[model samples]
Target: MKAFVLDRYGKGRSLRSADVPTPELRDDEVLVQVHAAGVNLLDSKIRDGEFKLILPHRLPIVLGHDVAGEVVKVGSRVRQFKLGDQVYARPDDLRIGTFAEFVSVKEASLAHKPKALTMEEAASIPLVALTAWQALVEKANLKKGQKVFIQAGSGGVGTFAIQLAKHLGATVATTTSTANVSLVKSLGADVVIDYKTQDFEDVLRDYDVVLNSQDTKTLEKSLRVLKRGGKLISISGPPDPEFGKEIGAPGFVKLVLRLLSSGIRRKAKSRGVTFSFLFMKANGRQLREITPLFDAGVIRPVVDRVFPFESTNDALAYVEKGRAKGKVVIKVR
Candidate 1:
């Protein structure tokens, strides 16, 4: 099967096209014949060796997180799905390799694709949507009539978080540039700040939760907007000690993470708020719940671009530019 392979970790290095053996299926896994794959900043960060500590991969690997395709084969232990099932997933961190003709995904991490969506659209949903669900619903336990500020409201996670927050009955405030103000508002953002002109800290205050997906500087600024006991979840991090424990980091890596996040953790403590990092994982059950919302028209997929499989590198490059209004996808079939 043809797939893009990363030979070494480096910034600005393009994936090399090659014919590699199809992923070996496990008893609890399904082999998906990839029709489409999603491009994420996570892909780029892994390529640049940014996540070496927490998500170390074997050398000469395939890198992709989001996948939508048909199940060509399923393992004996797979009960809910079979051959010819249309499915989508953000495969487990160690199992990801959807930028290929075929990638094997664990049955627990896979869910049926929404019938209303195209493969490209389905491909765009898993990683970013899961991030939003995990951060707001699972971590923050956001409630109705509460206020939440979601930074970078037009980016991959932002577009989805805004809608999900609104669905959960929270007042949603988001930050984006002038070109994307209307887009975020249309996604049900109650307040939209033009980051190019207005500072979000000045305009947002006393929020119940904040979904931070920006740099260290922006992450720090988000603290002031939250009310006492508010939840501050950073997807882009200075990762905290809790996250290190979750991923079960090495002793040295744990120490490094503790030191790196000490300043922000102390700041959050002083402000009477809690800080945590979110690195979303795959969950078939969560995707099953989310599919109904899309089917019911409560949440919609926001796809900004679709590139051919041959242009997978271009797709990754496009996402790295930080200009996409939503998700970027690579059509593999």
Candidate 2:
């Protein structure tokens, strides 16, 4: 099997294409012949060792998270799929490479690809879409008619967050550069603000939820815009211990999380709003639940660019620019 292997973490490191042994399937796993993989900032972070403390990985790791592929083999306990079944998954951790010709994924983390989408488009949906679904629907329990603000409406998670928030019937407001205002609006954002020219804190008030995917300063400002007792769900993160516990963070990770979130939690409490950091978990069940919306045409993928598999490095660089309007994809098959 050919894979994009990372020799070490650094600047301007390109994936070295090489022959690697196929991953042995676990009892609850599936071996997938990857058709396409989605590139995200997390891919970049993993490559650069940005998450070393929280999610450690060994060297020469194959790096990719989101995958859309076909099942080539199924593990003994994997009854939901068989050979030739089309599936997509956000790999449990950075260790299982989706940037390869084939990868092994836990059956519980894989979902049937939406029938309406192509392999490339399906690959783009898993991580970002699941992030939005978990943050808005599962964590916040956002209700229709509630005002919700999503920052960076044009980026990977923002694109999905805006659509999912609207699908849940929330009045969605979001911020992007002027160029992407129309893009976010088309995705069902009721109000789109140009972050460069306008301050969202000044223009919007009393939101039920704020999906924060921006920087520290922007995240702090998001708290002020929410109504009292409102929630701010940050995916970019200052990982809170409570949030870590909710997601089953390890003991050492929880200690680190408590220290990291202590300051932010105090500040949020002073503002009379609640703060929770969101780390999206891979769950086939949740993906199955949301696949109906995509198939029904209520949700659509917004792809900004598709890079050839050979240009996986370039794809990461593009996402690192922080200017992508939606998802960035790599055609792997």
Candidate 3:
């Protein structure tokens, strides 16, 4: 099997392509012939060792989080899918390797691909879409007629979130450059702030929820815009103690998370608002639930580019630029 292998962790290091042995399937997993894969900032973060303390991935690993492909074989306990099933997933953190020709995924993390989408488009959905679904629908329980501000509306998570929030009937506000104002609006954002010119804090106010995917300064400003009892969910995080506990991090790591988030948590408490960091987990059931929304045309993928499998490095670099209007994909098959 031809795969891109990360030999070491460092900033700006490119993955080396090599022939590796096919992965052996587990009792609860599926071997998928990769058709396409999604490139995310999380991929780059892991490569740069930014997540070493939390994730601690071994050296010489294959990297990719989201995958869309056909199931070549299923594990003994996998009854939901079989050979030839078209599926997509954000594989479990420890098992991710979708940047290869074929990757094995846990059955519990796999979902049937939405019938309306192409393989590339399906690949783009799992990681970012699941992040949005977990943030808005699961955590926030956002309802119709409420107000929510989703930062970076033109980015991967933002594009999906804006549409999902609107589908949930919330009035959505987002931040993007002037060039992307119409893009976010077309995605159903009711309010679009030009981050290059206007400050989002000045324009958005008293919102029910604020999805913060930006810097500490931006996160601080986001807190001020939320009304009392509003929810502030930071995906680009200062991981809170709750999140550390959820991941069952070591005591020292949990203490680090507590220290890192204490100031923000205090500020949120002073304002009577709730704050938590969200590190989205892979869930097949949630993806299954949202499949209908994609099929029903309530949410659509916004793919900026599809790089050939040979250009996987280029695809990662493109995503690292942080200017893609939506997701970047690698056509692996």
lDDT of each: 0.94, 0.90, 0.95
Candidate 1 per-residue lDDT, tens place, 1-333, comes to 999999999998999999999999899999999999999999999999998889889989999999999999989899999889999999999888999999999998999999989999999999999999999999999999999999899999999999999999999999999999889999999999998999998898799999999898999999989899999999998888988899989999999999999999999999999999998999999999899888888999999999999999999999999999899999999
What's the TM-score of each model vs. the native?
Answer: 0.99, 0.97, 0.99
lDDT, candidate 2, 1-333, per-residue tens: 988899898866888989999988899999999999999898887788777777768888999999999999999999999999999999897446998999999999999999999999999999998999999998899998999999899998998888898888999999999898889989999988998899999999999999998888998889889899999999998988876677577898899899988887898999899999988888899999888888999989989899999988889899999989899999988
Q: Which stretches of candidate 3 lie over 4 Å from their true place?
A: none
Report the backbone clash tally of model 2: 0
CA shift of 264, model 1, Å: 0.3
Clashing pairs in 3: none
**Winner on lDDT (1 vs 2):** 1
Instruction: Give the per-residue Cα lDDT of candidate 2 at 236.
Output: 90
Clashing pairs in 2: none
Which window of ten consecutive residues has the lowest lDDT sum in model 2?
A: 241-250
Candidate 1 root-mean-square deviation in Å? 0.7
TM-score of 1: 0.99
Off by over 4 Å in 1: none
The CA lDDT at 75 in model 2 is: 92
